[model samples]
Target: MKLVVQEFLTLDGVSQGPGAPDEDTSDGFTRGGWFVPFVDEEFMEIVDGWLAQADGLLLGRRTYENFARDWPAMTDHPNGAIMNGLPKYVATQSLTEAHWDPTTILAGNIVAEVDALKRQPGRELQIHGSARLAQSLLAAGLVDQLRLAIAPVVVGRGRRLFPEGSTPAGLRPVSQHTTKAGLSVHVFDTAGLPSYGIYEG
Candidate 1:
């Protein structure tokens, strides 16, 4: 299975809270719901397509708890079934059991566990909104694909996807498109370490 990381980010690369205002206020992050304005049916259709391609979901502790709390109640939505039924792996040491149906808790070494998971036969093992976990995988050179829905707004402060001095990565663009509400969705395949050279003008 190819390890895929899908994220929602602001123009300034903040990935903290794209859903609701109270969704994630950790470290006093008040810039929540910034991505809401750019979401339309077109974007949702694209998201549904993404959810369809996932054979299973890999989530961090926080993200897993958040989804486990809400997805069951969203059973009426078009994407709810996929969200609820897909096999889920939660990377956490604290959680002894996950109430979410079909969830496996990875309390051991996350990288090794995910590495083993990637070797299994499947389409895509998706990491959805698990930014911290995604960062770890990317740093370890384990992420296979990256799909980001970038909103056209700058959140002056929040947890960013790529902070200063982050591990460098190379991404090759596969496809891109715009939504009706001005969101840019870009898909890329990881290209190992980035190529470095001096440009002689």
Candidate 2:
């Protein structure tokens, strides 16, 4: 199984709070819902395509809690059944019990646990909206592909996916496109450590 990370980001690279104004208020992040405006029919179609390829979901503690609470009740949503029914894995030490059906808590060396999961036979084991977990996996060179929907707005402050002093990575572009609502979607395959080069005058 290839670990794929799908994320929504602001122009300034803020990954926190892309759903609703109160979706993620951690650390006083008020600039929420920055990515909501760019959701057109085309964007949703693209998203649906991605969801169809998901064999399982890997989520962070916060994201897992949110999804576990909301997805079960979204009966009217077209993708609700898919979201609710997929096998879910959460990376956490704090969560002893998960109310969501088919959820497994991964504790003690999360990297190793996730690596073991990647060894299983399947399609894509996707990580959706778990920026922190995605960051850690990317740093460990475990993420095989990344799909980013970059909104055309600049959120002045929020937790970024790649913060200062983060591990450097190299990516080769697999695909890219801009939506009618100004979302620039990009897909990239992870390369190893970024190569450095010097320019001669």
What's the lDDT for all of these models? 0.94, 0.95
Give the TM-score comparing model 2 with the true structure, all chains together. Answer: 0.98
Could you estimate the TM-score for every candidate? Answer: 0.98, 0.98
Query: Which ranges of candidate 2 are over 4 A from the true structure?
Result: none
- 110 in model 2: Cα distance from truth in Å? 0.4
lDDT of 1 by residue, 1-201 (tens): 999999999989999989999999999988799999888999998998988899999999989999999999997988888889999999998999899989999999899999999999999999999888999999999999999999999989999888887899999999999987999999999998899999999
In model 2, the Cα lDDT at residue 194 comes to 88
| Pairs that clash in candidate 2 | none
